[model samples]
Each structure stands twice: as structure tokens, then as C-alpha cells.
Target: MRREWQVFRVATTYVGTVVGAGFASGQETLRFFAAYGRFGLAGVAVATALFCLFGITVMELGRRLRARTHREVLDHACGPRLGRVMDVAITFFLSATLTVMVAGGGAIFAQQFGAPYALGTLVTALLTGATILAGMRGIMAANSIVVPLLTTAVVFLVATSLHDLGVGPAFSQLAPHPALAPARSWWMAALLYVSYNLALSISVLGPLGAEVGNRRVLLWGGTLGGLTLGLMAAGMTLTVGAHLPEAAVEIPMLYLSRSHSQVVQWFYALILWAEIYTTAVACAYGFAGRLGQLWRYREAVVATICLALAGSGFGFSQLLAFFYPLFGLVALVVLAGLMRRSWRLGS
Candidate 1:
């Protein structure tokens, strides 16, 4: 039972690490999947498969390497030269994830709650900074608590939306919103979406994998996590489909929840912030961790938070629209490297 519980915990953390502000806000789903209409759900399937495959590989590699940080995992996969190059690239991408989360908080405040963007940015920074300061255990604890709420909120929204629209009619409502889509086709969107998230998640997975007991725990935890993420994406995609008009907004899911009731809107808004906070913590910690133990802990963290806050000036959608696909390209390189290394090792 204890062993099973641990695996569950690992799965929750993995899901939490990947399902950040972008995912919860409905921004990412809208960009990657919802914009393509019904075909996007097929993209969700593609992403789900990749998420499981890479999630397992990353965790298992972390266990083998006993890696304290994502840097080691990259070094092992790409070897010294190319690994160093990709390491720098991933570190920057993770930092961008932090920036994106910060921007997301501001968007939630502005778009969902009608609050000042600066106020939202400040609150997000403080909360995320506190969590990162608490270290890896802190990120794990936050995920364990927050991810469940996020899951519940998503399920509630999906159910309510489905009740209103019916699955067939709901999907029938979907139309190509090319302006919001990350890619022209669903398959391309799926690859970009998974690549982008895996880039952000390896930071947490790298260390968590090291602490995991065995292959069963790693495989089960990863499969569960990936599936959970895919489920949430599908749920949000349905909600977005039902509310096609609202799908163009920054936080489409929140807009759908609001259509149901004010109470539901308030609930999801809070949950959205929690999602942002957790992902911000992951990104910040990952960025600092990737520095290779060369910087002072307190200073590095504080500086990283400040830089992220500054980067939030990019605004939520602009950053998400541009940086995510760009980083996805870089992550594709890392993913390719990992696959080649795994093939050579015959494991």
C-alpha cells in the first residue's frame, strides 16, 4: 500500500509539473488543440502518447543517473558537447516557462477577475518565490495538494459543459480558429504541445526520478501522469468547443466556467492561480537547478524570480504564441537526442 501510494504521489507531481498556468488557463489547449476543432482531439491523442513515452524515459533515466538536476540528464543523453548546447537551450526555455506562468497570473487577474495586471503579477511572484525557496519537497507538496483541486475543477467544468451542449453537438460547434492555433494541423500542434511541456517538466522529473525506487514505480507513475494530463486537456478542449465564441480569450476555460455560474467561475479562477503557482515553482527551481551548483541558492532564486517578473512584460498570449513553438523546436532536438541514446543503450 505504501509503495502504491508513493507511485500515486509521483504521478500527481508529474501531472502537476506539466499542467501549469498555460494548461489550466485554457490558453495552451486553445492554441494547440481547440483551435483546430474536432481534429484537435486527435492531436490530444498524439500528445498523450508522446507524453507517456517521454515521461517514462525521462524518469527511468533520472533513476539510472541519480541526477540531482535536469542538467545531468541532458549531459547523459546528448553527451558532453551537444548536451552542453541543449542544456543551455533547455535552461533558457525553462526560464521562459517561469515568465509565461507569471504572465498567465496577470492574465487570469485581468481577464477572469478584472483586477490590475501588476497586482496579479506581484501576487504570483511572491507565492511562487516562497514555494521555490522551500525547495523540491515544497514543489512536491504543492503539487500533491493543488493538482487534485485542478483535476476536480477541470472535471466539473467538462461535465457542466457536456451537460449543456452534449458531446456530439459540442464537437459539432468546433470550427477552425486559425488565428489562435499554434500550428496549421493537429499533428504538428500535438508534437509542439508535448515537446514544449516536456521541456518544462524535466526539471522536476530529473530529481524525482532519482528518488524513485524502481522501474515499476517510474513506469506506472509516468503513465498515470501523462494520461491524467491528456484527460484534462481533452476536458478543457470540450469545454472550449462548447463555448467557441469565448475560445479566443486568454483563459477560455474560465470563460466557460463563468457561463455556468459565478461561483464556478470564482472556484476555477482560484484553481487557475494555484496551477500557475505550481508551474512557476517548477520553472524557477528548474532554472536555478540547471545552473550546475555554481550559484548561491538564495541569490539565484531571488534573481530568477525578478527576471521572470520582468519577462512577464511580454504579456501572456504573445509569449505563449511565439516562445512555446520556438522552444518546442529546441525540445524536438532534445527529444531526438534522447531517443538515439536510448536506442544505442538497448534499454
Candidate 2:
């Protein structure tokens, strides 16, 4: 029972961490799955399967190697030369992802509460930096409290929105693009989405799996994490599909929740902030860990926080649009290489 609960906690944490600002805001689904139209449902299914399968692979690999950090697990998974490439790609993605989260948090604060974006970004960066500096225990402790609250709030929002939303129209909006109709390929988008998220998540999940000390725990954790993400993706799609035009203002989740109730709106805001903390902590920890390996410069590590804050303060939407797809492609290449290696090993 204790072990099972631990697995649940780990899974929730993993899900909560990866979902972050974009997933909660509905932008991630818009960019990845929702872009597919009705075929987007097919994309969601493919993404779910990849999340489960690759998520398991990542956790199992971590458990087998008893990795203390992503570097060890990635090194084993990709080999030394390719691992170096993976490491650089992951580090870059993490930094960019953190920037996105910080920027998203700022946008949420500004739009939801009339707070200045600069003030919100600065406050979020400082708070998240403090959490990261406290280390893994701090992260786990914070998530223990925040994850459940966020999950509950999201569930409530979904339930309330579903009561009012028309399913027929939502489905109609999801039709595939006419230009891409000939390709008959929803699989690529799904694969790309999962590959990208998993790449960013590996830094957190790999170390988390190693910590659990049990394959069962890792498997269950990964399963829970994947399912949670898929559910969020579906919910975001449904909500956004129902009211596509209203989502143009950025932070679609906020709009969805506000339409339901003021309480729901406030809850969503709090949850969004929590999601920001999760991503920010994960990214900062990963960055610090990587820098500790490459340069051993503590001052440089602190400076990275300032850099992230400044970059994010400029504009969240622009940063997200620029970084996510590019990183998605890089993640696909890394995953393809991993799959090839796994195939050879199996043979």
C-alpha cells in the first residue's frame, strides 16, 4: 500500500510537471493535437500510446541503471557520443521550456488579475528559483501539496464546462486540414508531440525513476503520468474546440474556467501558477545539474536564472511558438535514434 501510494505520488508529480503552463493554457493541444482537426482525436490516441510506451521505457531504463540524474540514464540509452548530443538538446530545451513557463505565468497574472507582466515574471522567477535552490526534497514537498489541488481544480473546471459545451460542434471543428488530407498521416503529429514532451520530461522522470528503487513503482508511475497527460490533452481539446474564437486571447484555460464560475477562474489561476512552479523548478534543477557537470560555475548557474527572467519578460507567446516545434523536431530525431538502438538490441 505504501509503495503503491508512492508510485501514485511520483506519477502525479511527473504528470503535473510536464503538463506545465502550455498544457494547462490549452496552447500545447492547439499546436499539436488540435491542429489535426477531427483527426486530432486520432493524434491524441497516438500521443497517449507513445507517452505510455516511451514513458515506461524511460523509467525502466532509469531503474535498471540506478541513475542519479538524467545524464546517466541518457548516457546509457543513447551511448556516449549520441548521449552528448541528447544532453545538449535536452539542456537547451529545458532552458527554453523554463522561459516559456515563466512567460506563461506572467501572461496569466496580467490577464487574470491585471498584474503587470514584468512584476509577475519577476516574482515567479524568484519564487521558482528559491524552490530549485532548495533541491529535490523541496520540489517533491511543494508538488505534494500543489499537484492534488491543481488536479482537483482542473477536474472541476472540466466537469463544469462539459455541462455547457455541445459535443457535436466540438467534433466538427476538429476536421483535418485540406492541404494535409492527401498524406493520411495523423501519426506523425502524435509521435512528434509525445517525443517532444518525453524529451523534456526525461530529465525529471529519469531521476525520479531511479529514486523509486522498484520497477513496479516506475511502471505504475509512468502509466499514471501518461494517462493524466492524455486526459488533460483531451479536456483541453474539448474545451478549446467548443470555443475556438474565445481562445484567441491567449490562456484558453482561463477563459474556459471564467465562463464556468469566478471560483473556478481563481482556482485555475492558482493551478496555473503551481504548474509554472513545477516546470520552473524542473528546468532550473536540470540546468543547474548540467552546468555543474560542464563548468562547475555556481555563479554562472545563478546568472542563468536572471537570463531566463529577462528573456521571458519580453513575451511569452512568441517564445512558446518559436521554441516548442523546433525542440519537438530535435526530440523526434533523438527518439528515432533511441528506437533504432533498441531495435538492434532486440535483434
Candidate 3:
């Protein structure tokens, strides 16, 4: 029973770390997979496979190396020279991704509540900075509840939206949307989607693998987590694809939920924002932690919040579209190294 509980906790941690603002809001799925129409569904399949494979490899390597941080794991996977390069890339990407999350918070407020964008951005930044200054314990506790609620809500929204659209028609919409798709090819989009998410997730997952140091536990947990992500992506793709140009908003999940009722929309918007808040806090904390007091962590937190607020002007969708793909492309090198290292680790 205790072992099973450990597996469950690890699986949930994996899922929670990956599912954030863009993801829970359905924006990530919309652009990365749903935009390509039926082909996007195929892309989700490809991404699912990679998520499972790479997730396991990451954990296994973390366990074998007894890595204290993702940097150690990266150093082992890539040579010292290349690993140093990747470390800098990961650190920079951490801030970039946090900026994206802050933007997402503003999108949620403005799009869902008819609130001012600037107000939303400022509020998000303030709240995030406070969370960082106070420490992560509260946010981490909140996430334990938020991730499950957010997951359930996503499944419900997707099911309802698909039923209203008719499942056959939803899946049959073969016309591509392609407005802000990161890649022209569906397969390439899938690759980028997994790559970027893995980049963000590796920070926590690596440390987790070292803490557990159990191959069986990591393998089962990662596989389950990957499969759960794939399921959510598939559901979001179908729902968003069915809605078409109308669903091409900043907060697609809220848009879909509003069709059910204004209350549902409000409910989802709050949940989505909570998830975004947690993610922003996590990102800011992680980025500061990695800096290791080169500056005071609180000062780093303040600086990050200010920078992220400035970047939120680019808009959530635009930032995710541009930066995510770039990060994914660079992170692909780390992924390739992980695969190569895994071969020797297994031996």
C-alpha cells in the first residue's frame, strides 16, 4: 500500500509540473495539436510516445547519477562543455517560461473577466512575488488540490464541448487552423511540444528521481504521467479543433466553458488562474533557487516579476508560440543526450 501510494504521488507530481497555464487553459493543445486538424491528433500520438520514453529516461538517469539538480544530470548526459551550455540555456528558459506563465495569468483575467490587461498583469506579478517571498510551501500545498481539480474540470469541459459539437464532426474537421502553430508540420509540432514541456519538467523530475532512486517506481510513475498528459491533450485537441476560429482566443477553455453557462466559465477561469499562479510561483522559485544567491533570492524574485510583467505585453499566446518553440529546439539537444546516456546507464 505504501509503495502504491509512492507511485501515485510521483505520477501526480509529474502531471502537476507539466500542466500549467497554457496547458490547462487549452491554449497549448490548441496551437500545438488542434491547429493542424485531424493531423494534430496524430501529432498527439507521437508526442505521447516521446513523453513516455523521454520521461522514463530522465528519471532513470537522475536515479543512476543521484543528481542533486538537473544540471548534474545534464553534465552527465552531455559532456562538461556541452552540459554547461545546456545549463545556461535551461536557466534562461526557466525565466522565459515564467514570463509566459505571467502572461497567461493576465490573459485569464482580461479574457475571462473583461478586466484590464495591465491590471491583470500587475496583480499576477504582485501575487507571484509575494508567494516567492513567503516561500513555496503554501503554493505547493495548494497545487496538491489544484492539479486534481483542474484535471477533472478539463476532462468535463472537453467531454461536454465535444458532445455538443458531435464527436464525429469534431474529429472529422480536417481543415487546419494554423494561426500560431509553432511548426508547419504536425509531427514537428508534436516534437517541439514534448521537448519544451520536458525541459520545464526536468528540473523537478530530476531531483525526484534522485530522492526515490527506484527504477520500478520511476518507470511506472513516468509512464502513467505521460499517458495522462496524452489523454488530456487528445481531449483538448478535439474540443478546440471542433470550435475552430471562435475558439482561437487567449483562453480557449474558458470560451468553451462559457457555452455551458456563465457560472461554469467563471468557475473554470478561477481554477485556471490558480493553476497559473502556482506555475508562476514554481518557475520564479526554481529560477531564483538556481541562481544560488548571486543576488538575494527575494531581490531575484522582485526582478523576475518586473521583467515578466513587461514581457506580458507580448500577450500569452504570442509568447508561448514564439518562445516555446525556440526553447524546444534548443532543449532537443538535451533530449538526444539523455537517450545516449540512458543506453550506457542501462548497460
lDDT of each: 0.84, 0.74, 0.80
lDDT of 2 by residue, 59-87 (tens): 67666677656777678777888888888
Clashes of each: 0, 3, 0
**Model 3 error, position 118 (Å):** 5.5
Winner on TM-score between 1 and 2 is 1
Q: Which clashing pairs does model 1 show?
A: none
> Per-residue lDDT of 225-295 in model 1, one digit per residue for the tens?
99999998988887786677656776777777767678888888999988988888888888877553878
lDDT: the better of candidates 1 and 3 = 1
Q: By the lDDT metric, which is better: model 2 or model 3? A: 3
Give the candidates in order of TM-score, highest first: 1, 2, 3
Best-matching candidate per lDDT: 1
**TM-score of candidate 2 on Cα atoms, chains taken together:** 0.89
| Poorly placed runs, candidate 2 (over 4 Å) | 166-169, 176-185, 294-301, 340-347
Error of 3 at 19 (Å): 1.8
What is the lDDT for 199 in model 2? 85
Residue 127 of candidate 3: its Cα lDDT? Answer: 84
Q: What is candidate 3's lDDT per residue for 1-347, written digit by digit as tens?
A: 47776677667667777888888878888889988989999999999988888888887877877865578888988889999999899888888888888888887778778998788888887887887676534444555677778888999998888778788987777469767577789999998888888877777678678877788999998898899889999999988888888888877887788778777878888888887877777677667657644787767777788878887888887877678778889988888888787677657
